[model samples]
Target chain A: MSIFINKQTRVLVQGITGKQGSFHTAQMLEYGTNIIAGVSPGKGGQNVEGVPVYDTVFAAIEEETVDASILFIPAPFARDAAFEALDAGVKLIVLIPEHIPLQDAMDIMAYAQKQNAVIVGPNTFGLVSSGSSKIGIMPNRYFVPGPVGIVSRSGTLCYEIVGHLTGNDIGTTTVVGLGGDRVVGLNFIDVLRRFEEDPETKTVILVGEIGGSSEEEAATFISSSMKKPVIAYLAGRSAPPGKRMGHAGAIIERGRGTFESKVKALNAAGVEVAGLPNEVPAMIKKILS
Target chain B: MKLYEYLGKKLFHRYDIPVPHSKIVESPEEAAEAAAELGDVVIKSQVLSGKRGKAGGIAFASNPGEARKEAERILNMRLNDLTVEKLLVEEKLQIEQELYLALTVDGALRCPVVLASLDGGMDVEEVAEGRMIKWPIDVSIGLQDYMTREICRRMGVSGALQKEFIKLLPKLYKMFRELDAELAEINPLALTPDGLVAADAKVTIDDDALYRHPQLPRVKEKTDLELKAEELDIAYVELDGNIAVMANGAGITMATLDMVQHYGGAAANFLDFGGGASVERTAQALELLLGTNPKVLLINIFGGITRCDIVAEGFVKVRESKGIDLPVSFRLVGTKEAEGRAILEKVGIKTFNSMDEAVRHAVDLTEAS
Candidate 1:
């Protein structure tokens, strides 16, 4: 009853022999994710945690059916890995590396669109559909299956807020980290529309930040056609202007992507916007009741 | 990551882009000497931030004496919070038209966008009111000649002028891609008597891609604390406060800063170790945080790819090596959470899983101090 993934969603790990890829591959396995294959160019005949490793995604797809892929490739090689996955007919991709070159990200985005596939991040923690399955690197225990579908542009901030929501017994159907980059694969609008269509997701939580206009676009979408109750929280209210606050996309430029502008947009769209992350649960509770 | 005007011009020259002759100078005497060689110069205060024209950072000097006087005035001036330490003395152009040209990523379009306008020599923000022509380029095909011609024609360029833009747009796009630059800009591509030349250059290379570009000049625009953090490979932004804040991700760090301010506490800096920080890297981050001289150190870790036990070890390593004696609050969660808490507790460091509780404790401790 989740949006992107569940128990039946078979997955593969790209760059699975790397340190991070190996560690998280084991973690995802322990979380009961339906991992089917692993890809490492040189170590083709090897096996990582009982999953067969192949030289390429196409070679891996030759033996088994993989519905999604989690990429742990280095930033420089991430584009090629992504293109290979798309070319192999894998529709969903979770890119874990940060600091990917902007041009490569653009190319990946265009290529993914042409294939009608979904790429989650160029810099992200990935996604988890509560107890059903997890494709990202987020700590899965903090989440539980429920009606609230979460979408965010951040990683740890999403974790902290989800911790608060789950602590208060407000579980989630799916939580998506839209990534913390300038040109991400999927944005708030795309995730929001998916959540709106999912029957299990009655409420949605949109976590946005300063720097880009994705939140503004989400506000426009919510105001016009959204039917589900949504609560929004934006970070970087006190962040200094112009300086990039850690994230490449999390910056204020030419007086745009300010906290004031995003808040105003969300509020004008008849959406309840929490000034602080702690206020999210209360706002969500009030709306659902 | 942001190159000064002189440096940007050097890059422009290397890429065969036409630029006005320029030389960088620190002292007024040096400026005078350079201006004498290139007469009728423009004395531009070399600061990273834009809008130098409005800040009076750009001055026209017809003579070497005027250039010297202008440099003296500007070298001691502060524009947009950045002090002018250097000047770019360049030959002034006999301009006929000013056009804007930039290659940057368009977040909304999810592609590289080329922006052009007939009106330039002004901040693009000032003229974004429907006067600019924007073309989002498909990265696979790149900035095609037809797209360039269409953008130039829309910007009111025609005939020879349109052809010039078509030739230059791809070069700009190439510079942006080759350098891994976030922005490759010519604010005023002046149509001078000598033909179209870049009057001003604004190039910003991605800090993450600096490893790929060893030839690019490393500008020291950061403060002492920021520079130290950069050495440790941590993202740090200095702020005016007494409480130093650290986190695993940007969004959480920002939220932590906001929460500290909400509780009447100011954060001294914003630092993120990113994901999957090793023990030594974490220890280095902690050591760098202490360099800020804060009243209290607030460490917030929400481990996803980053394990909490490793972060806990980083704290202990810093405490043992650097002899940290300041009041510190720790918020640790996810992957090996209990083990992380136990490690911190063994070292007499109390840990809280709740971010709110940790922030509140840190603010209270700092306020008491």
Candidate 2:
């Protein structure tokens, strides 16, 4: 029992003929994701790693049941691919492209909302439901079935933290990447709501970074409503203002989204904020004990 | 990519928004010549930063001679670390009223928002909430006629003035949409004796969207090392600290920096080579990090798609190519970690599996130094 995706969830791949698409498709298949069809515009009638390909998402959906769609299209073409999937009624979209235009991201988020769908990232590493299904680019060995639900904005940071957890004999139920862009699809609150409802998830770990009011907003939700204990680790405390720190959304603008503000919010909400990445697994152990 | 004032006005003028007649000048002679033609002009230093007025980057000249002096003074001035090299000499308008109009993305609303305030000529962030009207624009429908009319009415704008606003707002919204701008601002949309004119223009295009809008000017406001990092396609930001930090992801890199500070060590710079970084790219990133000449170097990599062995080989390659004497704390984990550690070991470089241990070691080295 996992949130968003599992072994029974049939998936579709957009831009499946591309280098990243083909590689990840094989990786997803290896991890036992139920991939049914692929979309590559002109590469219909072809197969990638035994999954059938179609010219369009509509064409692919016509033949196979695509519960979710993972896009490997580049940033410029990501919007169109996402729209194609949404128009075909694919509810869960994993957008795996970086440097997507901010306008395109806004439109994608708005359109996805209108269609009652959820998009994981436009600049993301996607999500994995730990031993059940892997839709993202995270290494499979780092994740195993466990009680902790992990949601994060940064991909590699999430992986590194997950490695700490798995290495310490802690497993996760699902790991969702919210993307490291100014505008992303699913945020901390969105994932936290799911984690709170999941019986398998007894504790939640939020991996947030500087920039944007998402973490502060998530803290508000957690304090008012959440029953399960949550731990948070925020990055970019040492970053200077007005400089973009790798991620487009990871900058402190106009004194908002600073590390102090986020840590204050999370702490005020009764969530333990880890000072270092390695401190997380120990904190989780204490909470569960 | 924040455009200079002159460039923003150029975009505004191209999109049919009304602006003061202006000529961009580089030298004091050109400023005098432009002022003579325009009459009673304002000499504005064309820079990417705001608060130009506070920085003494703006001056009014009643005559051409004054304009030349003002230009000469401004040209030598550095506003917010940016030297003023160009001036936008424009006709100073007789202002009847001032208003604020801007179209910017609202992260919370997840869409473009039009911010209108009758109280202008100051930072909108400082403006009282009640005085400002924020209308979130749905990207699907865009800025509609009704929305603009409502905004104008709320600001007590009517008659011919309302008509001017009705005509102007859409054009501004069009420029915002077409240019893929993060912010399109008119801080003082002055009601002049001639007509409504933009007193100042602030336009910032999305850096990610710059590839599509190649015609736009690229402002160089970065340090030499930052520019070099840009050319090498590595994410790097220099800080005034001792330990130089490098990692695989933006979050991890930032976290590495935070940890260095947490353990009472200041980080010299932030460098992330991004995921699946090739050995060559890794070597280049390492070389760039070393260029900072920090007291200690901390490399934290949790390879997922980015292999540990690849990153290790990059360290070995850099060590073989250029001799390194600095204390280096390298943490390698995930995907072929043993092989990566083995490669580093061959070069007498010790690798740690724990990020905390590696960061503490680096901080200790910096402190010891």
Which lDDT tens digits does candidate 1 get at residues B1-369?
A: 889988999988888899998888999999889989999999999888877989999998988899889999999888988889889999999999988889888988898888888889887888865779989988877778889878876777798888788777788888999988889999898998777899999998888778778888898889987888888778999999999888999999999999998888999999998888999999888888888788999999888778889999988988998898999999898888899999989989998878889999999998788
Number of clashing pairs, model 1?
0
- Chain A, candidate 1, TM-score of 0.98
Off by over 4 Å in 1: B81-83
The CAPRI class of candidate 2 is high
Taking all chains together, each candidate's TM-score versus the true structure is 0.96, 0.97
Model 2: per-residue Cα lDDT over B311-364, one tens digit each: 998888888899778999999988889999999988889988788999999999
True contacts kept of 1: 0.84
Considering every candidate listed, which one attains the maximal TM-score? 2
DockQ of 1: 0.78
